[model samples]
Target chain A: MAATDKIFQHGTLGLLVPGLFDGTITAGELLTHGDTGIGTLDGLNGEVIIINGHAYQAREDGQVREIAADETLPFASVHFEKPDISAPIEATNQADFETQVVRDYRLRNVFAAIRIDGTFKTIKTRVAPRQQPPYKTLVQATATQPEFSGEHVQGTIVGYYAPQLFQGATVGGFHLHFLSQDHQLGGHLLGFEIEQAELKIQHFADFQVHLPIDNEAYLQEEFDNETIDHAINKAER
Target chain B: MAATDKIFQHGTLGLLVPGLFDGTITAGELLTHGDTGIGTLDGLNGEVIIINGHAYQAREDGQVREIAADETLPFASVHFEKPDISAPIEATNQADFETQVVRDYRLRNVFAAIRIDGTFKTIKTRVAPRQQPPYKTLVQATATQPEFSGEHVQGTIVGYYAPQLFQGATVGGFHLHFLSQDHQLGGHLLGFEIEQAELKIQHFADFQVHLPIDNEAYLQEEFDNETIDHAINKAER
Candidate 1:
């Protein structure tokens, strides 16, 4: 129950890259760690965007809905922290925005949580299709996934920025998901151009990973280094 | 303030490998996260072993002493939990012990804290040379480190078992430090053979890493993947 500015994450990209998508912890359980963050739901069902203590799931059909408390999650990152720095940003494109933000704000090596509220000039994203048993690897799932894009959309972008050292366990760069104000569209952010936005970032030095140790697959499976690195780069980047 | 059975660590082997040895968090503050763990003091002075809520430092000259409240840490891993399982062990060599324990106890892939108290048939260890400014990388520092070894030693071994996924973030395998019962000897464990020992382990699904974000060295340094991986494998193994 410590309201400290640290991230609480469930599972890892390493686990998900290999297609172990069964939900281990529930949405209700995840909320205890943080009030704002992002992740995906059970079986990689779309993308998870947590805002203001509420959990929402965005599906591949450009649909958004509040998740049930009991719904489980295979991978997610949550945090409870007020913004340490908030300001208006001018960078538009994804690459430019990331480069400028990390460089200008001195967020190069440490971890941080970012939230940007604005109208995007052009936004493009995709959602993971919900999977059943015999789940496919993330690369395979995203290979034929549906994508959504628009000219002008007002929404919030939320995610965590991990250092380069956490390459496979988490995203080495920003891993963000978007959710529209109207709750009509959004998913994992693939590309974006912000027209005007207020960026709020909470830089923290700590990250807590909650592994699914109880999952039989997690305890028994061997995680090869090259396979994880290659799969994450191919699927997430 | 939550007494959850998770490995709470400060800094990372990635940071240490590059010689960012300045302590960011004090020993007093680290104890709030876990009581039993292992770490190194500020300036990479020596190896740390926490047992029964007390912190002890073992130096290269075969000396052990209680750490002060104000002592700082460059890296550490700690947890507060009663062992889930405790029993006598028969494996002796480092390789055999790690393989058997992980295989027999189903500890593969998950994170776990291991504690072994035993009579050693033979033990070998080394302590970091107390360092100052213009610190050398771990590989360079450990190159000429003073080592200690003996036969028929009674002591305890404490450390964490990180899955291969951790890699340079922590020791991908077992990273242990040893301390003798009489507080007369021990350091970073290089090798050992147990005559008889009792093993205690707590399998956990969570690991919390506390980065030294405020350290100017940590924030500004560009951690190269090839450098970190190579340095860790060369020095730690």
Candidate 2:
């Protein structure tokens, strides 16, 4: 069936929004589900980017290093599938890229694994502060987050595109994370101007989300979905 | 992992809300995913309830019969697992049952396969009018749908419990369908007064939703999540 491509995701952005950052899903275990993905580490430590079976953590303090196999991830989306469609994309910034992808590729209602690799005229990224215990909601934690940018940069953007209905389950729209070719700069993609790039997208007809069923915080806590929606929009948007 | 239990679902409520009723996944294929389940037949002919490997359709015209293996399903949630927790439930009606289930079973944030079997002092059910080509939205189709009731009914309630965050992916809360033991009545549950009922619930950390990617109606059409949400609440509530 053409509907066979699947995306496996661990934990919802809903669980992460309310400061439930303690996680046990290891990077080693996550790779078993998908060779490429994007997420944040336990305690909402740093941004996680997985590509070609290798995982890396882009710290908020501006350090990109390989993630330990045992490193835990609170939330992530992964998939192992060859692209069904590959083409050149036209867009000036991240928002424009998402808008065009939604209009041109017609992906506003479904999940798509997106990868963009090439040179760029400019690139901008941001990362949340490494949080600790007694953690605050995502909106509070990212209140003073840092941003980084460069001109004439070359990098790859990796992430998943979820429909707006999945806002609390995951960040809606294109939640892309970037990494430079030199492995020196990267985090969540905030904006970019591509000089030249190739877009590879795989339609995920099957979306499998694994929740934190065993966690006491997840099972016992009273989650506020409406509030989380606002918090996610404020933090990610 | 207690998180290993999965609910395999075909299609989403979001797709159904947009009037994409034609389906291709056969009843036989659906049973292969789970021994017990709930859904609707293709073209929205009726409510489908599967238990103990047998699929039955509660038609809108009051005919309850075994569903053919070739029958197609537009949407369904099924799982192959024994209950993690089973207990006696106390509730005066369906709403009370749901409120107690959410509060006592701690199922507000998780996906669960729920079954309640026993006698009821009174029962109420509904079935949407069948549609052909040029279908209307689910809300419109079910606006004046028929409702049936019975006193001292012996039957089983079967369906899935989806968290509010999954509102579009599936109906939020308990979307149960009923089937009488004598095969005299059944359909989407509306209201009920239980004499006594046994509650069997399986925690499902894994929720896998399959979309009709090949359906032209699903692919090209633009969907409004806000409108769908309101429609679902009106129709289901």
Candidate 3:
């Protein structure tokens, strides 16, 4: 059986692996699971793009390059997507657009993997810088993140919408990452105003989590749930 | 690899499988994944008890029998557990008991698999009657369910406490089932008053959903989040 046929995830997002420098799962190995998703490179170098079975690294310097098969990542969410619905939408901001999308598509309570491709009036994004050992949590890592804003940025946003009940295991609400069509701009999506775009969602009827079962940090951490939740909210925000 | 080493589940509670009929996964196969959990029998015959790698059929007639390994069930949640913490507690009612458990253990905002064994002052439960084809939703099926109340019932309560974000994937809050020490009375747990009990919980850091991917009803159903949520709440209430 093909491994990538399911929603393959690696590491506990809640357990907080500080950086990707020691990421255990290889890009080549990960690709065996899904062809499209988002993550970061070794050392939390920048945003990661997995599309059409090719992995790309988009850096803070706006330099985009193809990641080698041997390269690894700290965390990622990917799926062998087969969209059940495709539709067009119009909206001005992130909030209104998401509300309209959900209302229009009637996707209130289901797990959905979505891809939106289009032009935007303004796109705001952020990429986490590289890190060293004695790492802090992701929220702390992103506290000093660099922001990018541009007009008429054409890109694709890829992510998922999980029911709020799955907040810890997955972000309960919409979580999206962006990559420019030219491959020069990309990061965790902060905000964007859609000019026109196509919204495609695959009914994600199943989910699975693979943890760093042998990782020392994951095993030792007490994982005070409130602290982790707050950290996740801040990072997502 | 041992299958019981991870949490294993089948079918979608969100899709509301009406009765335990034509269930494909066998008890032997399920035991290969987990040793303890709860579920219903064919045609919603009665409660199912699985513990220590053995399966028991607890029927409406208060008859308990060792389930053949080949017997199947509609829904169940179980894990190969290694509890992170175990302690004692006191509470007077279901709400108070749950509150005390969370407070005493300080379990918040995390997915937890819990087991409590001891004497209960009052144990209240309900079981769905056997259903036929053209089945209704679980909410409808339990509309006229039978309730059983017993004083000083000795049993073990088994279930999970999922964060609100996972409400669709699992019951967002505490979802539990009970099996008496005698194994003659059991079903989905509705309410209980703890006289004295030891609470054991595992930091269930992983989750996986295995749906009846080929079931026609599952494939065709469009779940309305609000309606399903309401139904679940009413049934649990």
Candidate 4:
């Protein structure tokens, strides 16, 4: 198949043209006047066109079209592939339920607030959308804390999204914040893994949601409250 | 005021608290509970709490107050100042319009398109934003083309936006694309430049709006028929 057809069939195209910054002609191409009739004559597989009454090379299957000599064409469109977002969740406080519970919740909440806030700020300010899909998302969390607090607590967590998360942004990289309330306690207590659960919408569709395998819903329902309550109730019976 | 308060009031909160990568607090302090905060206490003044659940320190009229463990103090709030946004607008592309009217317009449009497209793509794929502007808005419209296709155009243009115009986004760098068509010569050309721009947004509301000095709208207006017609007429006359 012709380059144009290949691009069309795959919904993508690229060319590593020399002397063009390793230029890759993806699905998009800029076409001008010469591209129209020249293809048939030269056995050129692309389109033809005329600019300022002069012929020029043009891509038959590209999204951009020919412009008059007097008119101008902007870069048309630009985009980059989204990054991956997946990790294991660590349940640090699972070992010491009593003390870890209150401290872990506080740390989790604080870390969540920071991560969400930072990611949102980054996306909104840094990223600019070009077309859709692979919506960019940022996830920041921590499982460790410093020992200066005199309590054996997890560390402080902080994360920031590069481009703030938009309505349909894709997800990217992980920033883990670790903290410990007590100075002496050692080892990774937060031992939970994260699985890619599902992609959904949240905040009234204002944000694209990524539910981590160790999401809050599962923790509260299956692990934390439910498990604890069941154990207590069974013991009473 | 105490050093900590000074830092907070000066709006250098990020600095006062050590960053995740390069922090002031020691690893042992991070792992143990203590009275001293892990990060820098620089510029702090007024009532503050050090160490986890430790006594409070108050700085009033340059005097320091140390609260006892048994003391119960009234509630208080601390506020930090906001950073300045409006700085001098750096002008670029400050060159004499020596080129023919048509080429000038095409060059300007190409420059605008490339800058915007490059920025959008970079932000989308890479999490970092550019630190400087992408294109010099005040391009010197010289009639001469570079000996090399991708080289920067020589000759000085006064009143141009300097350092290229990627003034938005919080991280990464900027990229520029330049397309030039010489109606008098009957051909087209393309080129590019890369740079950086950065912005920090502390709140969600700050991310909702576009950067203040983006020249996109102005560039678009220049591409209108009226502007092109006027330039062409002047050239012919």
Candidate 5:
């Protein structure tokens, strides 16, 4: 038998200590039955009292008191301490960028990711265009829902920003996008659905806006004559 | 063969889709030769096909693409959202009591069971004692240095409670206890070990704290005190 199996048998014999056996037993037999090898037995004066390396001695006091099973055992007890909760200084890091869009001096893009929570979703936003100042320019802007077709997914805008691209300039505009998921596009390839799906662009009329283009006055009036378009489309039955 | 064995054979057959065996005639013949009686011949029929009670129809133009040996399958992407932060309302039925040396009041004791992040282990907090007016009591506590030893655990006081016991005419000499688990003392018990633990109890030295005299108050207070004491003792070792 394997050493592990022999050890298990010996352990069982230890549990059944002080029990009577039917078979005749010698010192070697007893040691083998207990699964203790010959090397573990200690012989003294041929009396064969010691076995399995432990000395056997008779107690002077013969009488013993019986105890209930529910009585507590003589075991050790210890207290446990609470854990620490402060955030480590080096553990925090900057948020990762999801996506970016750039169109000449103007940029319209959306980015989305998860926080500490396990919710699956994303965020959408837009970046304003850079321009010269003192010219009263008309800017058109519109916000629309996002479109999802065949595994192509996007999100709605919770907020937006219209910062001036040029130094010392103030410009403002509107930004928006529809939010949904598409399954037909197959994978994460972009622009594939743009060619396959019927996309409608909603146009917004010119709106009054301001920006700074010169360093002398640090103020300038500009018109964003560009139309802000947003659209959402789904597959037809 | 047993039903479980038949199910296993069916599972293996399901892995061999139409495109998977298109170029392997030998392998297909070997699989078909097995008398499993749990397979369909037309894996890409235009009409709906049923196998093991599951119905699937192949699209006319949409054919299953053969997966490359080295190519990996695409997985779904997810974005998680942040949690909403809000305060919980305090419990009703608060009362006040007075004593010769110290004052006491009754406040609803709230205990919350919270699971630690990342680990499945659970740690329960002791019921907090909130005192009434004139005591200027607050239970602003935080957990720190939480350590577990055998069955007992210990934690440091990153925070403390001023006037740990409530003092007043309606609620005097009020104490709080935190229990880890409920068990009979005379039954089989587990030993606990602790490295370091401490609770900074700050009370007025001029007044002597008295245990509650009323049966209801006395029993509750006794239970709470004993639980806290036991936990502390276990943790302190």
Candidate 6:
């Protein structure tokens, strides 16, 4: 199979990049696999947004900057969005948007790669600050997460509809990350009010796994650490 | 990515072979992708077992036969298992076996492709019979599933550990299908008493989706039909 047809995941959510020191996978290398996805920089430095083949780092203080190809990521999940279906959605809140997608798009059982583009009358987001070791769980790392709320912003929501069974495997339901169309603001999506947006949907029927078994930090850590789930849901949700 | 590193899936569990008439994906074509996985024969004729590059059909009458390359499948998920970890396990029942695996093998939080070979003191299994058109949900079709129990049998348990989040996506967790060493008995695993067993494990770090969009039967079905989840759990679990 071609590299572009499958989802590329580095590191497991079971082992969140808490060992920020082990950010061995470079951003440039990740881009070769997919044109869009979401992830974090070394040290949980900030939330990441990759759209249209370029990477952006959204920091906790509500700052967004283009990341260089040399930048490395401890973990990330990305896939090229080749839409099989595209439609427009009108919703007042985040819940309304999801219901409309499920109802109108009929994307219930399959894995979906979605790109929603347009204006948001109100958008809420958060970015995790840099951390130090002994690294804490992802939830703990983001204990002091900074929230950014803005109005009249133009951005795109890049995310996937993970099947419910893969809840802890990936972000169970619709997991989305946002970036302003102008590339000025972005972070893990908390909520949004859509003024208007067009949705581009791609259905995925295959899966691939990219393990970090070779990394020293990955191998040495106890990935089955029980707290990882709580951390993952907190961070991703 | 090589074919060995990805899971090849045809059609969606939500769609099933409701239109059993649409089972156009040949076993030969599916085998070209991976060597180990499970599915049902066309028309949900029987449970399917593919291992070590060969296909076997376990029918409702307790008969097992090697399937022809040209045999078609409505849906299946398969991948070559390359063990990153292997070990021995001892347990009396299925539940005990799973707990021992999780505790000793530490296969939590990620997807696992596993093979368990050994002598079974007792084995309990079931096979879904062929369904007629104007088909019912998988659960209903499987309501009269035939049960088979055997003792002093030697076999291998072929299965995958799906993360909880992917609940409806693929059997949710630890889905195992058994094939007797004598090649005469096999079906979806229900319960078992293991005399002793050895395990070979592979961890997946990526995923790919292969949809059956070209099949006429697939195109005519409604995948979002809500009854699919109940049917899937009943038939799969």
Best by TM-score: 1
lDDT of 1 by residue, B143-195 (tens): 88889998999999998888888887898888899989998888989999989
* Tens digits of lDDT, candidate 1, A55-147: 999998788899989999988899996889999988989899899989988887878998999999998888889888798877887777788
Docking quality (DockQ) of candidate 6: 0.27
List runs of model 5 lying over 4 Å from the truth. A1-96, A99-113, A116-237, B1-46, B49-237
Q: Deviation in angstroms for A141 in model 6? A: 5.3
lDDT of 2 by residue, A154-220 (tens): 8889998888878888888878999998888889888899899999998887889999888888887
**Candidate 1 accuracy as TM-score:** 0.97
Off by over 4 Å in 4: A1-155, A161-171, A185-237, B1-175, B179-237
Interface root mean square deviation per prediction: 1.1, 1.4, 5.9, 21.2, 34.3, 5.7
lDDT of 5 by residue, B1-237 (tens): 221111111111111111211122121332322211111122211211111222222122322122222221110000011111222212111121112112211111110111111111222222112122222101111012122221333221111111211111001122211222221010001121223222122211111111111222112221222233233333211
* DockQ top scorer: 1
What is residue B75's positional error in candidate 4, in angstroms? 46
lDDT of 2 at A123: 91
TM-score of chain A of each: 0.97, 0.96, 0.91, 0.15, 0.14, 0.91
Q: List the residue pairs that clash in candidate 2.
A: none
Error of 4 at B100 (Å): 29
- Fnat, one value per model: 0.91, 0.69, 0.33, 0.00, 0.00, 0.40
* True-structure lDDT of candidate 6: 0.75
Query: How high is the CA lDDT of each candidate model?
Result: 0.87, 0.86, 0.71, 0.18, 0.17, 0.75
Quote the lDDT for A199 in model 4: 14
Model 3 residue runs over 4 Å out of place are A1-5, A17-22, B1-6, B10-37, B40-46, B50-61, B65-75, B78-206, B210-237
Q: What is the lDDT of residue A190 in candidate 5?
A: 18
The full ranking of all candidates by TM-score, starting with the best, is: 1, 2, 6, 3, 4, 5
Candidate 3 vs. true structure, TM-score: 0.65
The two-chain DockQ for each candidate, comma-separated, is 0.83, 0.70, 0.22, 0.01, 0.01, 0.27
| Ten residues in sequence with the least summed lDDT for candidate 5 chain B | B73-82
Give one digit per residue, the lDDT tens place, for model 3 in B1-237. 544334666654665533325465678887777877766665666667677777776666556688888777767677876787888866768798788766665445455678889999989877767677777677778788777777899998887776544555567678887888987677778898888888888765456767665555554465655665677677655
